[model samples]
Target chain A: MSTTAIPTNTKWWNGGRSPFNASYGKVMMWYFLMSDAFTFGAFLISYATLRFSLNDWVDANHVFNAFPFFGHQDLPLAFVSLMTFILIFSSVTMVLAVHEGHKMNRKGVENYMILTILGGIAFLSCQAWEWTHLLTGEHFALTKSGAIEMLNTTVSHNPWGHRISGEVLTNALRHTSPDVLRSMILEHNHSATLASLKDLNANELISKIDLNEVYVGRSGPAAFGSYFFGITGFHGFHVFSGVVINIVMLAKTRLGHFEQRGHYEMIEKAGLYWHFVDLVWVFVFLCFYLI
Target chain B: MSDNVMTAAELHMPHDTSAGTGRIWKIFRLLSVITIIELALGFGLARHWYGEPELHHTAILFVKGTMCILSLAKAFYIVSVFMHLGDEIRNLMMTIVVPLCLFIWFITAFLWDGNSWKNLKNTNAGSKPDQTEQVVPAVIEKGAKE
Candidate 1:
């Protein structure tokens, strides 16, 4: 391979021809990511719309919490928290891989690439756990936008979730006070049951009740789950694609192409994609789980 | 093929090396700290426990948005230094950043339209009960049941 092509003589100077180089690959990836971000953004915005439109049904805390371990009480999203950390850690490793790629250290880049792939898998597993936990409980009963009208139907086709026990939700419901909840909804000195609570004022309804609403929709355990599962699931799909891309890059790393080129833009491009995944998770955590 | 002696300008060996652990590491560490703080904010906000200092919706939104802006910074850093995106011709940087910034604003606008004060107004409108235009039969059922 003669390193003889001068900058002026290269096909890039000709302007109209396709070089089929790494620049095109990276640009295409960026374009694809930008479009995908828009899609995710649309879903999230729609969620916020439906959530606010909801009269009585938005309960961020109770809906998204994890099944607590060992203490006989269910946890509050500890699993998702772990998922977030894992993703960020993976991003860190990805940056390191790019760094090593620059140094033409094929072995180091390959190792870190494998590590990033494993981290992505770990995050996906945690998400799988989170999804199953949400599907089984609470979403069967639909609530009106103003938090009134509990319709009778579970959201999922399966009655039982894969990870969480129905008993946990049953216990939560058992512990919840429909009486106090009712009182919270009723105006001062007014007695209104949850049954007769239709056409209740939506804003005043949530404003009056201090306690958290139970799981989100009759469609699912919480409304957050809809956003949670949808947004996180989509992002997870991106992570999966990234892993596949990395596997290809890893194969290239083994073949000594990266060393020959003496630049790790391919790996760096993958980092951009990976970082985007981590970035989206941050938003999901803040919007769906935190607030 | 014309046999020609190509100039050394042809030898484009990129100065790729272990330029990894310096400033970029520092920036990544900063990002990690921000993320940790974000987690703390999340946990703090999750509980509605009394005396825990409840934050307003605007406040929470600002804090959360800050995390996103930090990511934009990280993206710039990665592209500029790692991908050499910043070293491009002037039109190129504008081509990337300007539209991206516009998209951010666009995302923010739609989010607000669907979820912000406008949404608040919608909820208020939908939730307002028609006491003046009462559900008389429902009241009858209530009175009768009583």
Candidate 2:
């Protein structure tokens, strides 16, 4: 209890004490995060390895250019930057919650925990919209026969390929079938129904599509879609589980469970997991979206 | 012998309450600024504002390198401050930090092998064709039939 330093000669690690000078639960939580780090590290590294091996890959700018409600504005990285801010803000709220826990302020902890949960859900919602946009959105890709076809990005498919232009674009347009051309035109001129566009021949349909407006691309590296979905899906899964853990912790806090125990270490542990989720997103954002 | 049992006082040692909310908000601001800078660089690269024609590739690489370093800085703040790892004893911090060093070699070996594979494939094939060159056109041609 004295302010004076302990004797230098005293044995610091003579057993029967936490050599780390931390609680058992906290120590274990750190180790758990460490292992989880390795798991994510491996996934991201493999993704990089694949990326490096490929000569050409899908551009993040081309793929993630859509913004919700903005309607095909070509705002690259805009939505993802919003998602990153949501996660970061939620991380702030979480740290505030833990700070409140340190002060034994139950009301503060509850308020911040709710905010953090909302943040997590918002991030997940952004991710869902991104996946839906990628899967459902039609893109123009050059087929093997030099015809252009409309395609969506899938785990096995990557519609975002090298840009096709000039003579290649003209030739691909000529080879494209009437039906595919009709559908491709309908994508741009949505006022025309499939039935109305159905009557037009491939040549007329090609005329209907403004060559300047048509962004024709070929298939990119197949592994691009797989890694995008796989890594982000895995990260989204973690955020889902973290939100669940935070909810349980909130319920326990409201019920005065930690109050009874005289410590809110459970909240602290949950905060660790939440922060780890945010940490992983930083790398995920860097890998998938930025570099 | 007395240290064998963790005293109640030791288990729940008092924290410096006076450090206050100032530090938390400061860190929050720091993280936000870092992210904003990263986004700005990303936008610049995407818009082709940063790289000149001849030096474009290296310029883009420089921007990416800066972003990576910024991301690592953000990660450090989240771990150290938000998770309160900075306040923990050095021994505990070392336990967490030391194992992470393995990632350096892990990344290097994997990426080196991947690049080597690319070179091997290119050399064996006599010309390096994109992976999609072999499979996608054929698949699309078949799909067109359906």
lDDT of 1 at A72: 23
List the pairs of residues colliding in candidate 2.
none
| Candidate 1 C-alpha error for residue A214, in Å | 12
What's the count of clashing pairs in each model shown? 19, 0
Worst 10 residues of 2 chain B by lDDT: B137-146
Task: Please write out the lDDT profile of model 1 over residues A1-291, one tens digit for every residue.
Answer: 112233544554344433322356665766776777677767877776655433223334555555535332555656667787798778778877877775667899999999999998888887776676555432323221223233322232321111122443333333333543454455342555566765445444444543333332222224444455667778878888888888888898888877776666678778778877876776676667654
The DockQ score of candidate 2 comes to: 0.38
List residue ranges in candidate 1 displaced over 4 A: A1-22, A55-57, A67-77, A137-224, A260-263, B1-18, B48-90, B115-146
lDDT of 2 by residue, A166-269 (tens): 77788998998887777667667878888787667777788898777668888766788888999999999999999999999999999998887777778888
B-chain TM-score, candidate 1: 0.52
Docking class of predicted structure 2: acceptable
The regions of model 2 sitting more than 4 angstroms off are A1-10, A188-196, B1-14, B49-55, B125-146
Tens-place lDDT digits, model 1, residues B56-92:
5455556556656654665555556544455444444
